[model samples]
Target: MASRGFIELLRLADMARARKNGRQGGQESDWQGIVFEIGGQRLVAPMGEVSEVLTMPEYTSMPLVQPWMLGIANIRGRLLPLTDLSQFLHVPSRLSQMSQRKVIVIDHDSVFSGILVDQVLGIEHFNRSQYRSEAIDSKSPFAPYNHGKFFKDEQDWFVFMPSLLAQDSRYIDAAI
Candidate 1:
């Protein structure tokens, strides 16, 4: 009986060791984000800031709202206001790409809404080591909500913070 108990303890120790190793390896890819195309630019939203991504859904147009506001959509029994990111940023979008728009839902703290983007390029796992925080161009509209950027695959993926966007008065005040 003592020998069997010893074996069980050894197995437990091995499992613990494996788990620790696994966690340590994951540190290299500490940051993950959902990459999407918006306004002819590739942007990435932090994984933690986005709840889910869904295809365009039917929504009722609301009168007396900003043109950027695509109105409210019924998402899983919850009303989610969909906003056109391109319109809000005043960025020009390719007309051909407009048909592939996807909704990126963000639900946190005081914000629960979906922002429409040109395309959802899937989740990207990036190492924090590749991050860059240099100041963005002064005239860039996205500069306000972009925290920094992650350089990967020979491209700069701006880390978009929907939380920051949510805090913007221009974004929240939708009434025309």
Candidate 2:
């Protein structure tokens, strides 16, 4: 009877260890990203692409610049051109000066620019298997720059590719 009880205890311990390992493995398989809102749409971007997030700063207007080009702002002594991301993508923007907004600074290659967004939702962790490489819709203004889409909490979060946007010719040419 004593030997049987010891064997049962060992089996229970093994089962507990398996459960703990399974939970940790699930977490390790998840992908992390930053979530933000732009043009009244929820979006996510890989954490690696974002350099920093800052409050909207006063900027100087440039003549003959595209309407999307808000102006130039001196951030930390660095002159960064601020652009209204929604306008650049041709999407209708619900953003207004009165509403609190933020600028997501993206630095890729030798290019650096600040993109104005509605507000940041927060950092989110998603399961890697949940990412789907499909267009959210045929009319999505951001279809070209969308890397993929992920569904979480019953909401579809489209993944925006900042690097691709930075490399686009239209984005590079700010002069009108």
Candidate 3:
């Protein structure tokens, strides 16, 4: 009878450890991302792609460029082109207070651009298995660069790939 009780206690302890690990993302297959609002759509940028988030910096408006191309801003001695992602995506702005807007900077490879977003909701972790690559909304302007979507909190978080945006001809050619 003592051996039986000891075995039961061991099982309970194992269960507790497993529960703790699951809560901490072990065996959770977690997918972490930087969540931000762009063009009124909530998006999750791949954690590795986003270099930094910053306040909307003052930039020098460039001449004869697409209206979405806000211009260039000097950041730490590096010139970063500021792009209004909502406008560039041809989506109406969420109309948030300008003070609340932020720039999601991407410095992948040689592509260094500051993407303006309505809001930065910080990092979030979702179950990797819940990410659906085929369920991305086709109507979203970001759909082209988006790779997948995560259903969280009853809403969809589209995965935005700014590295792909850097290679897009429409995004690269900023002439009026």
Candidate 4:
């Protein structure tokens, strides 16, 4: 009876360990994103893509550049190129004052760019199952850069693929 009880105890411990591991694995599979607004549209990007968020900074205007190229701003002694994300995405530009603008800095690979946005909504956590790989309208300007979308609070949060945006020729071509 003593040996049987010891075996039962070991089995219980094993079960408990398995349950703990399962919960941790489930949590690891969850997706997280930072929500932000651009051109009055709600969008979300993977949190890992965003390096920093800051208020609009004074930037020097560049000559012979597209309207979407806002110019370069000195960020902590680093010259960061600022892009009007709304204009680049072919959306209506928000007419908010400079003080109300927000910049989302993306530092990936050799590219470092600050995306001007309307506001930073905050971080949102969602499960992998919550994502839907639906087709975006071909005519939509965001169609090429959209990864997927998630729904929350009766609103759809479109996932904007920053990496793709970084690689796009249009984004790379700052000079006219």
TM-score of each: 0.81, 0.79, 0.79, 0.79
Q: Between which residue pairs do clashes occur in model 4?
A: none
Select the stronger candidate by lDDT from 1 and 2. Answer: 1
Model 3 ranges off by over 4 Å: 1-29
Per-residue CA lDDT of model 1 for 108-175, tens digit only, reads 78889889888877656678788999645768888999888988889888888999999999999999
State model 1's lDDT: 0.79
Tens digit per residue, CA lDDT, model 3, 1-176: 33133223433454567677675323434776778886667888876787777778888999999999999999878899999988888888886565678888888777889899998776666786678876466876787899878887787788888889988989888997
* Candidate 4 lDDT score relative to the true structure: 0.77
RMSD of each: 10.9, 13.4, 12.2, 13.2
Best by lDDT: 1
Please identify model 1 stretches exceeding 4 Å from their true place: 1-28, 96-99
In candidate 2, which residue ranges exceed 4 Å CA deviation? Answer: 1-29
Model 4 C-alpha lDDT per residue in residues 66-166, reported as the tens digit of each score: 99998999977889999988888878757658678778788889889989888876666677777888746778788887887987667678898788899
TM-score of structure candidate 3:
0.79
Question: How high a TM-score does candidate 4 get?
Answer: 0.79
